[model samples]
Target: MNIEVSTLAHSMLADLHNNNNNYGKAIPGHIPRVPPNIRNINRAAYDPKVLSIGPYHHGKPGLQAMEDHKKRYLREFLTYMPGELEKLEKLNSLIYSVRTLEEKLLSLYNQPLNIERDDFIKMIVLDGCFILRLLIKIRVRLESEADAIFEVVPLLRRDLLLLENQLPFFILEKLYELIPKPNSIQPFPTLKEMAFAYLTMKLSTDPIALNNLEAYHLLHFYDLILLPKPRDHLIFESNQNAPSTVPQASKQEEPGIKITAKKADNFLEVPFVEGKLQISCLEIKDVAIPIFRNLIAFEQCCPTAGNHLTDTRFMDLMV
Candidate 1:
């Protein structure tokens, strides 16, 4: 019943936040905006005009068609990457603001711990997660927008500074050659191994102690950037002794994956089907980026905080 009580309180708080701004009275005149750093970068990339004219892609004597296909493929990437870059810019701005964090997150930082250090690390991890997801969305869009090439340039120009600023940290600078935006920024050194490095630099706390406590949370994404290939394919071979990557599934249950979850009377759901990973909780809003993603939980309540006990024993039984 702890879940029931938390759900009830969350409903009430959400109602207040949506219908009324009444609680701002408790702490008025606080910092209202949190702008992220935006670094401006000058374009310094291979002139695509020259590459197109070269025999390899620009109709070199006998390989005109091959060059044409090459141009078409690279140009497609150019079209969609720009808009994704803009989303990244907006994302950078949103994570710096406290008002966007969930109520549970607010309580997490406000607890008995030294508030500032915890807050700083939380901000960095949260911000990095936003940028990483933005890139993922861009990859998805590029495939769908293959026929449209006109929209990419403006998007890149708008976020060029933000992208350049973040590249050194993400260590994706080498991709600059592959995705070299014509007339965009110069090559630069990468800030590889940032999260652990940052933690070490601020070693006021014990190393073993910090690592032990951070195991799970750090497990989620500390080295996500360092992964060998940022993208991977979930491929399957077709019949007739030929290799084929199935696009749509042949049978609903053939994927052999099972997912389970509990439901409430009116609100709970069990939505998965034959061959799909149905993510029902994700709803993207068109702001600086989505203000939130999935849910997170808090624990170990104290009586001095004037809270009553919740019936969470049922959850323990499942274990």
Candidate 2:
């Protein structure tokens, strides 16, 4: 027993030293998938029904319909470029660039991929081009000649925002840059601007410049735009030994206080007067619930994203 104890302690000490040496190198990106336990609760919330953009759900049976649309978008994008030879050369360059990054891109996900290198690169180009074309079409209000999916454009837009359904932002950005722009006096909008516009179609607030933002994916992009500047007073170092709870609004209202809902610039902006409290209007449609659920789940799983999650908790308190 004494010898066994001595050996275990030395082994643990070796592991501690090894970990210390490895500690300073930062992991490249957060896990792309929802936690398995969370997914078990509502599997549909984190999934895409119509399209699969990244490796996570690529080639799934149900998402096969959109694959043809992806090819069409790629062809349209190529045709819109200057010359056929220029288009071919540009595509070859993109394929070569993405092929070199295959190993790095694979590491972004939490699980192993069984895909071949060439197939994965091809999928990346197709999905990336598809997103680029969709954004431009929505931006320019270009009428689709034959595509049936544009009839249900609203539903298709939501499907793109699913947590598991994302291409790396850099890939999309690169593809957008390579494509030739239609005639314009003003510069073409950044990929971030186009995506934010598409996703938040109901909101009219002017987007902050894309140059100032950094995001891992579409969901992270949404979180950054919705997040307000941090107010120092919002942080509370609690001393409670047990969980803190709030009084029910109805129960507290009996003592001269009143609760009312009002529209705000964004969610989580609740203000109070002497006797009345104003809560921001948070539209909770059945469809939007899954969207919020997955966004919250992403923040919960990625500790680096916890600050945005903290903002969400602030909104919950207002509710």
Give the best candidate by lDDT.
2
Q: Taking the tens digit of each residue's C-alpha lDDT, what string does model 2 give over 282-319?
A: 77887777778777876765567666553454445544
Instruction: Kindly give the stretch of ten consecutive residues in candidate 1 with the minimal lDDT sum.
Output: 290-299
Q: What is the C-alpha lDDT of each candidate?
A: 0.29, 0.72
Candidate 2 accuracy as lDDT: 0.72
Q: Candidate 1 clashing pairs?
A: 1-311, 43-183, 43-184, 44-184, 52-58, 55-60, 252-274
Candidate 2: minimum summed lDDT over ten consecutive residues — where? 19-28
* Residue 289 in model 1: lDDT: 22
TM-score of each: 0.17, 0.80
lDDT by residue for model 1 (1-319), tens: 5999999999999876665422222221111111111101112221122112211122335423333433344333345345877645433443333334334233322123233544443433333333332232233232444333224423322221121112122212222223323233233211222233332222223334333321112211222211222122332345335332322322323567443333322111223456433423323343212111000010011112111112224223322
Q: Which one wins on TM-score? A: 2
